[model samples]
Target: MAPENQPTTGPSTFIGENYHIWVIKIKAYLKALNLWEVIELGEPVVQPLRVNATLNEIKKYDELVTRSPRALTCRHSSLTNVMFTRIMTCEIAKKAWDKLKEEFEGTSRVKSVRFLALKREFELLKMKDSDSVKEYSSKLMENVNQIRILGETFPDQKVVEKILISLPDKFE
Candidate 1:
């Protein structure tokens, strides 16, 4: 029987808008299922000379092959039909993950462009008159997180300073 905490259904479909969030969620799901290593490092190559191997070694190899296909199935089940089709040829979970990353996360040049745009958004972020302090903080944090994920580092003090500067005069 499955554990009470284990999800019986797969994660939501990914249509490409929030790849970062989707990746994080899917990774957590895979990790929970003990399938993340296969998606990251890939399946191990089996030795043909294993005919002389010990029984325990053979059992371990069998376990690996069994896990690989299950991981592949998990990967396919989590994606949309179109996205799944793109990675259907992938025999291993890692290959399918890499293909999805390359397609949705973009190349280095594209990432650089995205980083610059996110930076601009961060710079322009200001607490609107209608927004509460919590709402403003949430918006700021989201931009900060996206910037960090794109490989830009902002010191905590710098983020605090940005938040302070963005506040309305009432907070002064």
Candidate 2:
């Protein structure tokens, strides 16, 4: 018998909020199943059996074709009813992904505005002299994470510098 009580690694249902985090989690889930390529790149073309096609090539093509539906299913099952309706007719994983991205992540203009706001917040973060280092660092990291979630590049060095500059006078 298979092992019992094992926790599954399925993606959590995608509600309206936290779409960025859900995208990251769902990608991880798809990658674990070797189906990310199907979701990311869409259905692979099935070649007619021909003399020129190597066995490996045929096998790879078959695998992609077979896994495409499974990848779509994974994406479908991860959505809530309200979210599911948005992509109900999507026949491919990539289409479903794009639909969700467009709907929940917002349009490019909206995303650009949000990115700027988060960037500004991240830059303006300051550790108050009276605040404990732990509290201030926690707030700093939270802002950094929000910026990173928006697909911006915020390096650890920047965080370190922010920390150093914001150190209380006693720690200097």
TM-score of each: 0.80, 0.84
TM-score of model 2 (CA atoms) = 0.84
- Candidate 1: tens digits of C-alpha lDDT, residues 1-172: 6688787767667875788888888888888888788888888776653558898888877877777788888878878887788999999888888999989888889999999998899898889988888999899899889988776897889788988888898887
Q: For model 2, how does the per-residue alpha-carbon lDDT over 22-88 read when each residue is reduced to its tens digit?
A: 8998888888778888877878887667778888889977786778888899998899998899999
RMSD of each: 2.8, 3.6
| TM-score, predicted candidate 1 vs. hidden true structure | 0.80
Misplaced by over 4 Å in model 1 are: 3-9, 48-55, 128-130, 151-156
The per-prediction tally of clashing pairs is 0, 0
lDDT of each: 0.84, 0.84
Which number leads on TM-score? 2
lDDT of 1 at 108: 89
